[model samples]
Target: MNETEQRRATQLLQLARNGDAESLETLLASYIGYLKVLSHSQLDPRVRGRLSASDLVQESLLEAHRDFTKFAGTTTAEFTGWLRKILVNNAARAVETHLLAAKRDYRREYSLDLLRQAADESHARLNSMTAVHRRGPASEAEHQEDLTVLSNAIEKLSTEYREVIVLRHVEGLTFADIAIRMNRSAGASRMLWMRAIEKLREAMSNENHE
Candidate 1:
């Protein structure tokens, strides 16, 4: 975030810390898109038909709201970090819940710990995509703000393109896995991802200019 935006977030943080419900609502509401991106990026597509990023985000926000009084964050980065932990836990639960409902044997299926680990890794990697854009103080805050911008650009893409980008970049899925999920040949998936990245780049460029 810019200096002005960071200051604004800090103000909101203070109000939230003081139990201002409206400020808390406004502060959390601003992160809707960000939480969506994180949840969507980490949610395994195998279980996504039964779960949704929006639902996960809602659950995370609800949990955050309930625990807001316990939060000690004094800045946006710290607040976001706390929220992300909840998001990952929720995501891990979603994976376990859906897989079990699908009648998968627990012994054969991936462990819940693995699910959480993957979610954590994916979250970090996705943020790294934005983090690489700059380096210095409050870089993480800048990373998040850039993610908001990047998320906006990603949303404008065609569903096909967006899906490819999410699987390949956000979720760190290999082209082969993406192909299996998308029901396309590996070569086709690669081509789609290429196109998706190109479109995303153009969208980001447009956003930068605007």
Candidate 2:
């Protein structure tokens, strides 16, 4: 994270902890986009009428706000890690609830086999296509299309794997920053990240071959 982001995150965390609702929302806004991906990755996109990403993010924010006082962190990385944990947990709960609701509404449990199958198909489509994104308007359509595939691939990855890939690749965070974000020792983060990259590469290779 940059110095500005680091300072702002600490400020927001402190202000939100002090009961400033605006700060809480600011903090939430910073991470909402990623959390949306997190939420979507946990669900079947085919089931489009389900809970919205914003709803899950709002739920996460509510939960985070409730215990903001208990948060004791000074750096942006620390705050982000905390926020990531809360967001992931909230998303997991929302997914569980969605599955349950589906069962009640349709009289059958959500299908795990179906979800896994969807994830695999998503992975395959992502592999056959290129993955790219431009930072500014100068980017081409092909770049955007690449990004979409990569984004989907990132989402379908497991939680631990997803975090590593996004932080290291998509977000372009340093190993140190990722280590901080994951609240792991620097050495451990590096090791895990290497393995995660290998896993992603294997997935991509398999995706391309098929």
Candidate 3:
């Protein structure tokens, strides 16, 4: 969300708050990619194969739509925070539902607070990946746009490339741990991670150019 996007969102928020259903839909639709990134970050890895991040994002968006009138925020940050809370709650429910169906003990493995913490950590990791660290402190909207750009770039990566980057950076896995998870030698995992970083950088560069 840059200045233009923030202004547009504020306008839409005003309209949606005034009972403009179409504006509400458009506003929610604009956040699909952003929410998907959050969903992917917050989703428990054990259940990822069984549940798609897009599904969780859709569920969150639907809930947001139903409860739009309850939203009282005026700024984009407030609105984004509200949406993030919805996404986390929906993710928790989805994870619990799947784990229970599989007869697994979700209580021992997951919690809402943990999910929220993970989301924050993931976003922080993403922020660190950007030029924001070299520049001075970025505005909240700039940070949001950077995350969205990085997420979209990650989505364009090949499966193995994406997995290595996510495991090494997003999940903070060591080379040895990543080797075990990726079923490769430690050295091989290191090489793969390096290559993955290169590809991710390329993808992100392309995203910026676009």
* Local accuracy of candidate 1 as per-residue lDDT tens digits, 86-122: 8888876776777666666752445656655766676
Question: lDDT tens string, model 3, 1-210?
Answer: 344344466677788888989889877876786677567668877778878888888888999999988998887668888888898888888778877567666675678898777776765666677664247776655665666667777778888988787777776789999999889999999999899888888887887676
Global fold similarity of model 2 (TM-score): 0.41
| Candidate 3, number of clashes | 0
lDDT of each: 0.75, 0.57, 0.77
Report clash pairs, candidate 1: 1-142
Clashing pairs in 2: 132-146, 132-147
Per-prediction tally of clashes: 1, 2, 0
> Where does model 3 exceed 4 Å of error?
1-27, 101-104, 131-136
lDDT score at residue 62, model 2, on the 0-100 scale: 79
State the lDDT at 50 in candidate 1.
74
For model 1, the superposed segments whose C-alpha errors exceed 4 Å read 1-8, 44-47, 95-98, 101-104, 107-112, 132-140, 205-210
| Local lDDT at 107 for model 2 | 27
| Poorest lDDT segment (10 consecutive residues) of candidate 1 | 1-10
Of 2 and 3, the candidate ranking higher by TM-score = 3
